[model samples]
Target: PLAIQQTISVYLIAYAAMSIVHGPLSDAIGRRSVILGGMLVFTLASVGCALATDLPTLLAFRAVQGLSAGAGQIVGRAAIRDLFHGDDAQRLMSQVAMIFGIAPAIAPLVGGWILGWAEWPVIFWFLTAFSGLLLLATWSWFPETHPPDRRVPLAMRSLVRDYVAIFLNPRFQRLAAASSFNFAGMFLYIASAPVLVMQHLHLGERDFGWLFIPTIGGMVVGAYLSGRAAGRMSGDALTRIGFVVGGIGALIHVAYAALADPFAIPWAVLPLFLTGVGVALIFPILTLAILDMYPRQRGSASSLQAFTSLVVAALVSGAMSPWLSHSTLYLALGSASLTLLGWAFWRWERNVCQRLPACPQETTAVEPADPL
Candidate 1:
C-alpha cells in the first residue's frame, strides 16, 4: 500500500515540477512542437516502465513518464485560449472536459481486464500504444497556434520574471487557488480509491467502476450543462452555482459518512456525483479566466495554474490519502474542508475584482513589465 501511494506521488511530483517548464517552453517555441516532443518522450518512458523489473526501475520510469505527460494538458489549454475567446472558449473547454472525464472511468476497467489475462507490464505496454497513437494524431492534426510573432524568447531571467509576475498577481493567486482546491476536494476520493473500494466498501479490484463511473458520469453531465450555459449565464453566476452544488455534495457526504452503518456502494458513492458536477462546472470558467489574464502568455498562465493543482494533488495523494483513508468520516471531512477553501478563494477573487478600477475578467491581457 505504501509503495502504491509512493508510485502515485512520485509521478505527481515530477509532473508538477516539469509543468512549470512545459508552459514556458510552449510559449517560447510552439504548442505543436512541445506537445509532439512530450508525447514522444512519454511513449519511450512507457516502454521503459514496461521493461522495468524492480520497483526502483519502475519508479524511475514512472517519473520520466510524469515529466513528459504534463506537456499535452498544459500546452493544450494554451492552444484553446489562443484560438478562441469569451463564450466560445468556455463552450469548447467544457466540451473537451466532458470528453476527458471519460478517461478515469475507462482506465481502471481496462487495466483490470489486462491484469486478468496478463502481467502488470502489459498495462504499461497499453499506455505506450495509447501515447504513441496520441503522438501520431497530434502530428497529423495539431497546429502551431502560437505564432512566431507572439513567441517569447527562451531566456532564464525573463522566464523567472514572467513566472514571478504571474505568481504574485493577486487575481492569479485567487483564481489558481480556487481551481486547485476545487479539484483537490474531489481528487482526495480518487487517490483514496483503493481503500474506499476494497477496505471500506468490501469490493474487489474489478468493482472500481462503482466509484469512478458515477463520479465521471456526473462530470460529463455538468460539462454538458456548462457548455449549454456558456453565453446565457455570466461566469460569476456559473461559478457560484457550481460552488453551491459542490458544497451540498460535501455536506451530504459528511452526513452519510457519520451516519451510515456499513458504508455500502450506491449510497457511499452518490455524493461524489454532485462533487464531480461542481468541479466540472467551475473548472473551465476559472481556467479561461486565468488564461484571459495573460493573453500573450497564456502558456505561462496555464503552466502555473497546472503546477498549483498538481502540487496540491501530489500532497493529497502522498500525505492526505494515507492519513484520511483509514476512515470514511475523515475523508468526508477533508473533502468538505477543501471545498470550503475553494469557495473562500473564489469569493476573495470576486471581492478583489470589484475593488479594481478595471475588472480582470474584461481585460484581455496584462503585459508583463520589462525586467531590465
Candidate 2:
C-alpha cells in the first residue's frame, strides 16, 4: 500500500515540478506544437508503462507520463487567453471547466471498468490510445494560438529573467496565491478522502461516488452560472459571491461536524457541493487575472499559476491533510482556513490594485472589477 502511495505521489510531484518547464516551452514554440509533442510523449510513455516488467520501470514510465500530461491543460489555458479576452474568455473558460469537471468524477470509474475486463496494463493501453487520438486531433485541427511575433526567445538568460520578474512582481504573486489558497480549500477534502469516506461517513470503498458526484454536480452548475454571468457580473463580484457561498458551506460543514449525532451521508457531504460551486466560480476569473497580468508571456504566467496551486496542494496533501484528517472538525477548520486566507489575499490584491500605478490598466478598463 505504501509503495503504491509513493508511486502515486511521485507522479503528482513530477507533474507539478515539470509544469514550470512546459509553460515556457509553449511560449517559445506554439500552443499547438507543444500540446502535440506532450501528447506524443505521454502516449509513448503509456506504452512503455504497459510493457514494463518491473515496478521501477513502471515508475519511470509513470514519471514520463506525468511530465507530459500537464502540457495540454497548461497550454490549453494559455491558448484560451491567447484567443479570447474579457467576458468572452471568461465564458469559454467556465464552459471548459464545466466539461473538465466531469473527468475527475468519471475517470476512476472508467479505470475500474477497464480493469474488470483486463489487467492493469490495459489501463495504460487505454491512455496510450487516448493520448494518441488527442495528438492526431491537435495535429490536424488545433491552430497555432501563439503567434511567432509574440513569442519570447527561449534563451537561458531570458528564461531566468522572465521567471524572476514574474515571481518578484507583487500583483502576480498575490493573484497566483489567491488562486492557490482558494483551490486548497477543496483540495483538503480530496487529500483526506480516505478518512472522510471510511472514517467519518462510514462509506464502503465503492461508495466513494456519494461524495464526488454531488460536489462535481454543483461545480457543473456553478460553471454554467459563471458562463452566464460573465459579461453581466464583474470579476470581483463573482469572486465575492463565491467567497460568501463557500463561507456558508464551510460553516455548514463545521456545524454538522460539531452537532451531528453520528456522521452520515448527504449531510456530511452537503457542504462540499457549495464549496465546489464556489471554487468553480472563482477559478476562471482568478485564472484570467493572472494571465492578463502578463499578456505577452501568458504561457509562463499560466505555468506559474498552475505551479503555485500544485505546490500548495502537494504540501497540503503531505503535511496539512495528515494533521487535519483525524476528525471532521479538523478538516472543517482546514477548509475554512484556506477559504478565509484566500479571501484575504484577494482583498489585499484588490486594495493594491486601487492604489498601485503599476497595476494593469486593462484589468479595470475591460471589466471594471470591483475593488473588493
Q: lDDT per prediction?
A: 0.87, 0.82
lDDT of 2 by residue, 61-100 (tens): 9899889988988999999989997889999998776665
Model 2 TM-score, 2 decimals: 0.92
For residues 1-372, write the lDDT of model 1, one tens digit per residue.
Answer: 567656777887889889999998998899999999999999999999999988999999999999999998889999998998778999999977666555655677788779888998999999999999999999999989999989877677888878887888888889899999988998899888889999999998888888888788879988999999988988888899999999999999999999999899798999999998999999998888888878888899999999999888778877899899999999999999999999999999888774221364533333544444
Most accurate candidate by TM-score:
1
lDDT of 1: 0.87
Candidate 2, residue 147: the lDDT equals 90
Which residue pairs clash within candidate 1?
Answer: none
172, model 2: CA deviation in Å?
A: 1.0
